[model samples]
Target: MSQTNNRDGSNKRSRILSSDVYRQRENQSSTNVAQTQSGLIIDNETALSSEIIKEQLNSVDDIITQAIIEVPTKHLLYVKELGDNLFVSLSTKII
Candidate 1:
């Protein structure tokens, strides 16, 4: 906000360190994705492969079903029967 004079008697405006506006400059080559020889850019090679993605998703259902089946019976506080299916409520109490 103030001006300071240099030893040469030239007036120079001093920076007041304004934080109202911030800027970030990133270098392009520092990114996580690497450019292939064919000019194709890949980030985590297995992440984009369909076979790997399908394999990862395929196990999700089994993992979720296993987690549900492994829950302790004591945690089931409420149960409602609907035809051949069951709607169960699990307790979230810390104790």
Candidate 2:
């Protein structure tokens, strides 16, 4: 790959967080949420706690995952198995 493409690829790779890495950083307060790529740290007061969600979907692999996005809150809840094409399209658009 060209130098620019290689740099871009590295940037993308750096943004990815393993579940272990995420769990490590997930303890910080929501108000202290960093403005950089880390991992999703959903507020405990949200409708679904991350722990509960994980337990409910136990054993599934990457069906619903979280990642840091390039935004203020930095977190993105990525649902990989949304079966409805139109819903996915609209959701992506809204996002």
Q: Residues 1-95, candidate 1: write the lDDT tens digits.
A: 13333532332222322221111112344366666547777774434678878889888765575334455354453332332244243454435
TM-score between candidate 2 and the true structure: 0.24
Q: After aligning candidate 1 to the native by TM-score, how far in Å is the CA of 80 from where it should be? A: 4.1
Q: How many steric overlaps are in each model, in order?
A: 0, 0
Instruction: List clashing residue pairs in candidate 1.
Output: none
Candidate 1 TM-score, C-alpha based? 0.23
List all candidate RMSDs to the true structure.
14.2, 23.1
Candidate 2, clashing residue pairs?
Answer: none
Point out the worst 10-residue segment of candidate 2 by lDDT: 73-82
